[model samples]
Target chain A: MIELTVNGATHRVDVDPATPLLYVLRNELALNGAKFGCGMGQCGACTVLVDDRPVFSCLYPVSSTAGRRVRTVEGFGTPEKPGPLQQAFIDRQAVQCGYCIAGMIVRAQALLERVAHPTEQQIREHMNPNLCRCGTHMRILDAIRAVAATGELHRAGEKGPAS
Target chain B: MRWRRTGYVAGAVLLAGVIVFAAIAWQPAIPPVKSPDIAITPELVSKGRTVVALGDCAVCHSPEGHPAFSGGLGLRTPFGVIYTTNITPDVETGIGAWSLDAFMRAMRHGVSRDGHLLYPAFPYIHYTKVTDDDLRAAYAYLMTQPAVHAPAPRNDLPLPLRFRPALAVWNLLYLRPGAAPALDASPRERGRYLVEGLGHCSSCHTALGIIGGESGRYLGGGDVDGWHAPALDVLAHAPRPWTVEQLSAYLTTGLASEHGASAGPMRPVTDNLGDVPPEDVHAIATYLMTIQTSQPPTAPKAGAVADASQLARGHALFDGVCATCHGDGGPMETQLGRPPLAASSALQGPTPRNAIMMVLQGIPWPSHPKPTAYMPAFADNLTDDQIADLVVYLRSTTSQPPWPDVRDEVRRARKDLSHD
Candidate 1:
């Protein structure tokens, strides 16, 4: 059994140590926000935050996440009360297929947390790792830009139930 | 009274020594010549191009984003940094004023047209063996190039080494001027001339002494820019012994299906070799094969079992980090035909330096030509402990014993990274 703290809640799970974190998040913990795209690290569909740093959960072993805080898209907010970044996405309609949005949001959250008001160039460069095949990049950028403009990222989760 | 006489004797001896040294070291400047109006034949220029390619002049003299041969690349040495000189024929800053005789003397004697002793970092010791005809050909090719007026940077050496005349003593110790001994007309002989004279393979592949001369181990392996240049004479001892055909392929394309891709300092070398004629590469390979020292392949030893927790950590790290490309049935192996990690020379080598370097500074994607395999650098992404774990896990898969000094190697590689 290995201890994993996801979204501020701790859980003990029994799984192969080498199994990717994405598998545990989706299967055992039932946090299905992080999806599987390419099993390789190429695609960002399985991105999640390990101690506030975005990593490809599909390629990240669950063993390595022990004692470290892991945050999935579910940690942002519920559908009833979306986080500020999430609401920005909805406001901008930044989804075509929605497969890559969770990763895009998580990656952008990392950038915003590090830089409260990132410039256009900073946002583009920081978000470069996460790919949006649906060509929803412009809308995603607008959504992230909207969140950055308001400086309300800290209030993103205040209304939602704490994990 | 006796001590004062002794001091005077010592002073006189020192003064006499300085005078004698100056007499031996001072080289008279060759009178400057007008840029010659001799019409260079296209055929001669083409032949000169081949000669220049074999010599790998651009690899040193052409800093990236600079015009070809208009040099400003700083070569790091144990003594200090020596910057490459502009070889372009610009009359003001480059070698435009140098006559053919001046050029030949620089090649043969490691002296500049301005009567200063040239640093051995220019590799004139090996160049001294180049035939006069080939040197003339190289000059023809260089003189015809579009001249850029980039002046050479001053070397950052210790105060004593700043005296250019000190190199005259160094030359006396190491320089051997004259053409390479003529040989029967064979591909191997042609390969020898190129390798010894122009290619100067031994300059890197051979170990160096404390004073920076060849240690006489002669292709017994050496380090350059922190990466080990593996011994060429022991190619037979490689995990999969290198054949002439495979070596030729590797020399031309920078990849061998049986061995592995070139990385580190060898990458640019193989890239340059790729542009040369295939026959030249084949001849080089042929010559290299003839020099291989025969040694019986050792039987694989049983490795000591690693600590269970460390093994788990290492395995997990590999699955997460390396498995995307290097795992069994990975995309690189299945689709792209990259060799298994078992076949990698770095993993199978006695030391873990190369493996650590490869992980920290992954094979960068080449800009020109068709792209080959590319691995992203993990220097910032992975910690020193994490890299050591990965290296240990990879070593466990092979028949070789675990590198006991993996942590040290990782730290060394990190230091090398910062130095770069």
Candidate 2:
């Protein structure tokens, strides 16, 4: 049995400790956002955040993720209220059929969390695992930029001071 | 003085440990080295762009309004519908994180980063035929594009079917992941790969069992996008067996000698093929011609009937059910824009699969620009044995060379088209 927090909710599940965290999330917890693609972890279709670091969930076993916070696409906000990256996908019309979107969002969230402002090369270097066959790559960059700009706007509007 | 010196030594040791810890913890995570600057010179870019166009990567990769190279297209096949994924450079969402080696494996080896076999439907089988240099150039061009973060849609195939390891079994039967067959025959045979593989001419040109395996009457057109794909081999009818020059012209411009213009699915092929270097097109033409000529399918034996009464009954059934469109004296030219049955080389081919498929499925009505011809499916009306009797009757009555091997073809076609 392992305890994990996903999307702000805690869950305890009994299963093979060596099962990929992706399977635990999708099959055990019924979180379909994280997918299983090329189970060997080649395709980044099964990416998620473990302790705020992006990892291919297909390769990361549930045992290693015990007591860790796992962030998935569902955690990135819903259709009614989307997170910055989720909104970015929509604004750029980035989700075609959308099987890769969740993984893309999960991976992107890790990058944005660490590097508030990433250059094109930085973004490319960080997220090369996700493969899109539809060829909407340019728009994905624009979507990320849009999200960054929105983040900046929010930061400027915030009231802040160190006590 | 001794006590003060001891304190200093301990402090120095603590400082040294702190420095070592910092060195290990804050190591700069430099990205791996990519293929040394592919001289994206205008000439190189142009070469890469042409290859991109030839491969029609956009047809499978690009979705409407999506950034180019960011994938979202949906391809439906007999097995199931598979959605395209995002191929952008998004650090989190796209392949911006992949090494060049990973990309190469996916393309050439049909293996992904984690080492799962990709389905053949991805056409890596054909792509594997692409040269490393060309693949690199194409990759370079894609790398230059903006990264989209859109995810691919879930493949709705059944459970074990969706399992990646199952592909290991599929690979044994069909996946030969490598370059196209090396042509040792004439230049024409060499071009067959370009036409059949990357050109994907066989995707439409070849008759397939409804489930997507090769049909007996190879290159006798099948159905795509609701249009009938016309037969390409000499064994099938199109008024004339396309000569090398004619096929080359048809492939390049969708025009050929006095018979028909390519439209519908052929439009994209011609539009793309039109831009193909003339030399490549010629090579493809040479290859396509050589394959059929080498095979030289013999016609079924002529003028022999085991039972005269049975032949008469078969002939009577042909006149009633089939002769209106395919009869010897029927006005074949106006109804089907088709060649006369007596004159069809397809009739002389070893098997009557082509004729049977056409008769059963109906010819794609060709419209100029794009064909909107609708051929109604006939399985609801015809039985397996009845279709077989018709096959025997047609070969005996019309085909110059009797089609003796038709029984197996009928069996195969029936099996393939069972769902239809």
Candidate 3:
């Protein structure tokens, strides 16, 4: 048994200690937004936030996340009312097949959280760790850039006062 | 005449009461309709022509050697044969007399001017995602095509299936509510409109459900026209993940580094997509590469070198037989610019079929702009076992694992090999 906090919700789950966090999130918790791709951590499809930093869930053991806070794409917002970042994605149509988006979004979310105004090069460098086969990297770049230039700053400004 | 209207309704009621199964109409969540602003200028026609090409309408609508868009192509499906309708300006047989309103309705609602429910094979489900301006332009362009007097052949359907009303029921059961695409207005958005709307990329790339609607992760791939339409999503299963540059290059030119080349139905698609603006193709790629899925990795490959004995056999064969064109600075590399074996996309994908297909049926004549460096078929020249060993040798040298059934793949490719 392990304790896991995901998207602000906590649950206790029983599984093998070595079971991948992605498997638990999907199979046990039914949090399916994070997808499975290359299980070797070569593809970022199973990306989620561990303590607000993006990590490939497939290679990350569930045991390692016992005391950490994890966030999945579902934590972002509902489809009807997506987060600013997700809305930016949909508005830019930055998704296809949308299997990688949860990771893409979470990874980008981490980047934005760290660097509120990343340059295009910074954006590319940050996103290179993830692989998208559909060739939508440019749109993904734009969606992130758009969010950085506009909404990211506003949210960052709001957070600076408290943090 | 007075009783005809009442008779139709009463007969429908009686039919419903008797069968209780087949007579119900399907109700789809239809998007709110928008009246298109009409224009028939030459520029609009030119734009509309691009839209038509974007849709690849001619390929399916007109069979080979037939007048373009004449609409006699038979699309075989589980249900039955559904023939494409003529869109040329013929009053009796084609849509010549359809007003802009009628055309808009057809594009948006999948209904004919006479109110016949169209079979989904027409891909109106995707077309409805199109914007009114583009729809108008496509309509204007279609109207300009030379009128074809050809009437579509009668659909060979059975008694209950012959009635178009069943489509209403199917729509009710399967069709999700349609909503106007919320527009944010970016080039990527434009790409989305073309891809999701007119290009209908998902139609072929997305796997189909039991009832024929899109299933699984959209663009996760399925069979289309007898060829495996590889998934466009992140579970792409390409031996090497497609880089955006490689993807754009392939989508625009039909060949990408490492993945080799597009063949089968993809050839024509590349031809049509190539004709679109380069930026538009990039936009489509931009949209494609972002879709993600995850799966557990395949077991780590045993080793770079396979069984030492088989490796030696494959090496000897390659040196003796394949050495002429495939050796370092060999004819294929120097003259044809074919990548070295280590870099071949065929070797990189999850399966060996593409590589075997290449060996058995060398790239015939590449489309123009792509240099034509042809290779002859090796099926007649080499034994299946030898060919399989050669591929295994190539695989052993690369970081990629040897495909599971090399001999079986070679046999299959040889059986289907043709000069075309």
TM-score: model 1 vs. ground truth: 0.75
Error of 2 at B298 (Å): 7.0
Query: Which scores greater on DockQ, model 1 or model 3?
Result: 1
Q: Where does model 3 exceed 4 Å of error? A: A1-163, B1-39, B72-85, B151-164, B177-182, B235-240, B294-327, B335-338, B356-394, B406-420
DockQ of 2: 0.01
Residue-wise C-alpha lDDT for candidate 2, range B181-296, written one tens digit per residue: 54665566557656655666666666656434555466755665444465566522333556778777777765553343444445556666777698888988787666564454
Over the full model, what C-alpha lDDT does candidate 2 score relative to the true structure?
Answer: 0.62
Q: List the residue pairs that clash in candidate 1.
A: none
Summarize candidate 3's per-residue lDDT along B153-208 as a digit string, tens digits.
88766678777776776666545434245276666676676778888888888888
Interface RMSD list for the candidates: 3.2, 27.5, 21.2
Q: Identify the runs in model 2 with alpha carbons over 4 angstroms from their true place.
A: A1-163, B1-39, B63-70, B86-95, B145-149, B180-193, B200-238, B294-420
Model 1: per-residue Cα lDDT over B1-420, one tens digit each: 999999999999999999989986999999888884345778878888988988989888986556789999988888988999899999999999999888989998888999999989888999988987788889889999999989888888899988889887888889988989439677788788888889899989998999999985788778887787888888877878899888898888888877788898888788788888888888889898888887733444434566777777888888776787778887667754457887888888767888888887777656465656566566644667778888888888887777776887799878876654
The per-residue C-alpha lDDT of model 1 at residue B315 equals: 83
Can you give the TM-score per candidate against the true fold?
Answer: 0.75, 0.44, 0.56
Candidate 1: which stretches are off by over 4 Å? Answer: A1-163, B1-16, B36-38, B296-305, B335-337
Q: Which wins on lDDT, candidate 2 or candidate 3?
A: 3
Name the candidate, 1 or 3, with the larger lDDT value.
1
